[model samples]
Target: MLHLGLGSFHRAHQAVYLHRLIASGDERWVLAGGNLRPDMADTLTALAGQGGRYTLETVTPDGTRDYEWITSIRHVLPYEPSLAGLIDVGADPRTRIISFTVTEGGYYLDGRNRLDLSNAELASDLDGRTQQTVYGGVAAILRERMRRDAGPVSLLNCDNLRHNGERFRAGLLEFLERRDEPGLLDWVAAHTTCPNGMVDRITPRPSPDVAERVRLVTGRHDAVPVMGESFIQWVIEDDFCAGRPAWETVGVQMVASVQPYEEAKIRILNGTHSCIAWAGTLAGCHFIHEGLSVPAIRRMAMDYVTDDVIPCLHSPESPSPIDLAAYRDTVLARFGNAAIRDTNQRVAMDGYSKIPGFIAPTVRERLAAGQPIAGVARLPALFLAFLQRWHRDELPYAYQDQGMDPAAARAICASADPVAALCADPVLWHELAGDARLTAAVRGAFDEVHTTFAGALHG
Candidate 1:
């Protein structure tokens, strides 16, 4: 296994799952971790110091907490020679699968959903000098594999993006299409399998208090102990490049197609996070737990789910019919977990990429059905307002421990002229602005919520 972007979430979720598999005598797979970004150097250093062993801590229902020592990762490799080094890593015949939790924006695809070769960051990397974008690295690797006739390797994408595997393949193909190689893209299309996957694990960054708690549990001081809720679910499309681990033995739902599950989760679980994160932050709540404690905010979130999200799900025809109430309760319990310390800012980060999958799909579906998106409409508008506030330097950036810079955030936020950003970014505004009614609804809700939320926060 070659795991890219070895961050806290990946460590606590997929890596931990593999660790559990290895612990239970499935030691055939070991992770050779790679870090693309610079901050992860410290994380790599920490994990390497401990021989790639780290603690995954979780909060329990009865106020007790527990920790597990995860040791599935074997080695760390920095991108020393940019694309060349990454190609070398991927060219290894023994590495049958490459998994990524590199986040949504990490792919560096442009608005047309093609490889953003024009991107300055991407152009620097593709020049093969010393730059290293995920696309550049993956493209370079695929080119080498095509050259060396290396056996197949699956590309497992564990992010929340819809049709992730298809997107990864498309992004890669877009890059390859620019090259003059004969039968290379065809060979890749025939060999490489990019599996769409739904990965859910509430791995929140641990606070200093939680760090001390880690010391009490493991007797070893861990600088970065990932605190997650006990709940986890992975639904994956049943496809592999060379082959795959017996992930089904553990708990993954390996299906012929993960589309239905992916659609359901992207709209419900991820959408709910967006709904609360912005409104929660604007309300001056420090974390999701704190937000849930607020009656109005909590009520709004529940209403949004029940009135808006639940009706859209493809439930079973059985008598049970998938109890949405039960699911919502579970979500509430997870969000309201005080010990988990899931921050609004952590959830609120990456609104640019997150909105298209989580919120926009529902809005688009509703518009197609000629249904008003009142309950659904408010959250997006509130999020936009939050973005404006986050931009204007009015709010202190939450979840700083997890790669959120207030200055950079402010700049991104400042770039968001709701009218301009939406019109320009099709991933967000194309479908949204196309619906005049929805756009009006969003603008109206934005005005009302912004006033109410701002007044409430300031008061």
Candidate 2:
């Protein structure tokens, strides 16, 4: 397998799973990983120096800390402008699976589910000038594999996006069509399979203390150590074209349909996560645990799930088999793990993407059913408040949003009716962007957020 986006989450989740399989005497699959961009150069260098080995630190909510050496990654290909190493490995027939963990916004799809050409990277990739985007990188690899007649491969998507594999395949196909590569597109349609998969692990960016702790526990000075919560889950659709690992043996759920799992996680877990991050930042809390510590913020998350998402996802007429209530509690408990210390900044960075992907679906569902959206309303309301702080440069930390257009966001913030301006953003709300019901609900919730959390806001 060749994996892209060698980030901390991939290290903690996917790589850890593969390590378990390899440790269990199934060494048929080994990961050769690299990044499309030059992210984590220092860590990649450290990992390569250690022969593609690194330590993983996991902490349970009850304060149980553990460390293990992960050696599933056999090759850490160095990043070059041309992506020669990645293409070579991906084009190899033996490399049956190619997985990636690019974040939600990285797909560059607009509300209409079409390729967003406004993004400079996608534009360049379409022009065949660079392979910086996921579509570009994967396309280049597939084109080479076709040229070399390297047989079929599975394109696995390990991200939080709903129907991730299907969505990514659509984006890739659209990209190929625009590039006028009919032959390459035909080859990909015949030879590649994109399997949707859900990945979960609360991996925080490694702090310096993690390295120190790793050295203390493992008696090794490991530089590229990763830290994550003890809780982990992965549910994948069993539709690999070429072949796949026996991930089921390692507690991975290989299901025929990943829809139920993806919807549950994306809404219950991911949506609540964003709520806490935004509300926590507003309440002057630094970590997710700290946000959960605040009764008001915690209540908002609970109510959002109980009042909106659960009802929308699982109803009386057609009930879901999964124990959604238990799942909700488990997600909240995982978020409340103080030892994990998941930062509000990291969770709060991608609000522009989260609003549509995580929050808006509930809003859309509830509104369609003529139900009150008060609970789900709080999320967007909190985001509006957070964005105001960002606009005023009052946030304690920097905000990062891949999907946000700086000029457009600034104009919205500067507008006389900022709430209305925000509610009208098609990128964030899609067809419901300027809906009066959405604007009204968000406006009311905005007021409530200020009044209800007055003390926290001031703090």
Candidate 3:
């Protein structure tokens, strides 16, 4: 199999599953890692250096640990000038599925729910010179496969975005259309399969300390040993352009449709994470699992989910997709795992683009149903206020790197007034403000957070 964006998530989630499959003696599928980002060079080199073997440490519930050795990937491929070979491989009948873990921003869409043609990075990518965007490169590869009459292949997206595979298809098609790639678009629409998927695993970032600790534990040096929660879940659509592995054996639920699972995950797991991360960071807390360890903060989180979020779920009739009691317990346990010191900043980054798309939809649903998002409503509003402060250079802590530049954030937030500025951008504020109740709740909550946080800092 060909895996795009071979980052920590892929190694911790998909690779582990594939490793289990390989241990059970399935050898047809092996990952070929590719990246358009130069930053991945070190990580790619480290894995390639290790001979595609790494330790997977499962942070257990009772504070115990279990380790497993994974060898699911066989090779790594650098993003070369010409992606012809990559296309040829995907087109080859032997390849069954090609997966991706490209983050939410990688898709680059504007507020209009249309492809962002104006994206400077995206424009640069289509020039066919530098590998800039994932969509452009993916389109180039897909087009080549069509030209060569490459057989069917399923494209699976493991990202947190809603209808991720569909978004990938749209993004690729948009690129193809803008470039006028001829019948390639039609062929992709008709032949290629884009399977919507839901993947959940708490794979925390590995720092030098983590790497050192892992080495001490395993008695072997690992440059990128992945730290994650013991719990893992994967829900996938049964549709595949080429065939698929018996992933069911490895805890993959092959469903007739993945829409419900996607919605459930987005609204529950991802949405909650975004909320906690954004709000927690502003409140001087870092790391999601850490948020659960504190009583007041954990209470806020629980209230946000149960009192505010649960009422707004898709099917009030159906049982909640996640085991609420178990999830709360697991979250607290995961946070307490000192091995997985998942930074709050890591979760809090890119809030300008991440929050609305991930959690606002659920917040909107709750509002539409005339439900009071008492605990949940404040999250987005507070996030916006936090974004405002972040942009305005008013944050308590210092952020030196480029991930979420307070300066840029300030510029965006300061571009216009709060309600007007946010409401103007559909991507940021439309849904949340559409409901009169939510608008007021968010506005009031934003003010409350500002007041509360300000008092905590100054008083």
Candidate 4:
């Protein structure tokens, strides 16, 4: 197996699953992928020095901890600006599955799910000037595999993006089309399969506390140590071009379709996670559990899913994909796991992504059905107020968002009707824009949160 974006989440989630499989004596698959950028040079070098072995610190809700040595990633190639190592792995006949976790913004998809060729990195890839973006490097590698007749491979996307596999496949094919390589494209069409999956693990960014704990317990100065909550979930589609490991035996929910699982996760877990992040920031909390501790915040999220999202998803005629009530309760409990110390800043980093991807789908569905959208609109309204705070330089921490325009966001917040201005963003609302009902719903939610959190700040 070849995995891209060997970051903290992969180490704490997918690698853990692979490690479990290895423990079960299935050692056929091993991970070999490297960072495309030089920013992670030190960390990548440390992991390679350690032979791709790292300590995983798992913390439970009750503060109990377990440390395990994760060795599923047997090879960590050197970092290259061109991602030549990654491309080589893609071309290798033995590599049956090439997976990636390039974050939500890395896919370069427009609202229509087409490749945004105008992006600087994408433009560079289209012009064949840089081979770094996951798609660019994958295209190059797929071409080499076709030339060598390297046989079939599966492309597993373990990111949070909804319909990730299909979207990525679309972007990659569009990318390949730019080169006019008809034969390679045809080979790609025949040889590669993209499987959509949903991954869940509360992996906070690596910090000094985790590294220090690892050293104190294990008496080893191991770098690349990752930490996550005790709970973990991975739901994958069982579509593979080549044979795959018995992941189902190892607790992977190998199902026929990933849509139901993906939808539930995005709307409930991810959506509420963002709600708490923004609301907690306003309430002057640092960690996610701290925010979730506030009864009103937690209740708001639960009610949103129970009263708004699940009803829209579950119908009288069809079976519900998940136990919505149980899932909602479990999600809150997981968020309240203080040992994980999931930060509001981390959860809030990609509001521009979450607002649309995680939160908007429920709103859109409710609006289309002529049902009440008031419950779902709170998530976006919280984000708008959060964005306003960031625009005014009031946020306590550094904020980063690849999908947001700082200047435009600030202007929107500064306008006479900031809430309305924010609602009209084409990047986020898209076709749903210009609807008076949504604007009013968002305004109501904005005032609701404002009276709660903003009042607390003033008090």
**Best prediction by TM-score:** 2
Cα deviation of 33 in candidate 1 (Å)? 0.8
The runs of at least 3 residues in candidate 2 whose Cα sits more than 4 Å from the true structure, single-residue gaps closed, are 455-459
Best by lDDT: 2
For candidate 2, write residues 39-110 as lDDT tens digits: 678878988999999999999989899999999999999998799999999999999999999888899999
| Worst 10-residue lDDT window, candidate 3 | 399-408
Candidate 2 achieves a global lDDT of 0.92
* Every candidate's lDDT: 0.73, 0.92, 0.70, 0.86
| lDDT (C-alpha) at residue 35 in model 2 | 90
Instruction: Name the better of 1 and 4 by lDDT.
Output: 4
TM-score of 2: 0.98
* Model 3, runs deviating above 4 Å: 81-85, 127-129, 314-329, 394-420, 431-436, 455-459
Residues 94-199 of candidate 4 have per-residue lDDT tens digits of 9999998877878877678878776788889888888778888788778888878889999999989999998899888888888788888888889989999999
Q: Which ten residues in a row have the lowest lDDT in candidate 2?
A: 450-459
TM-scores vs. true structure, each candidate = 0.89, 0.98, 0.89, 0.97
- Candidate 1 lDDT, tens digit per residue, 312-334? 66434523234667877887888
Sorting all predicted structures by lDDT, with the top scorer first, yields 2, 4, 1, 3
Q: Provide the RMSD of all predictions against the true structure, rounded to 1 decimal.
A: 3.6, 1.2, 3.0, 1.6
Model 1 ranges with Cα > 4 A deviation:
79-86, 110-112, 116-118, 129-131, 181-183, 315-322, 398-427, 454-459
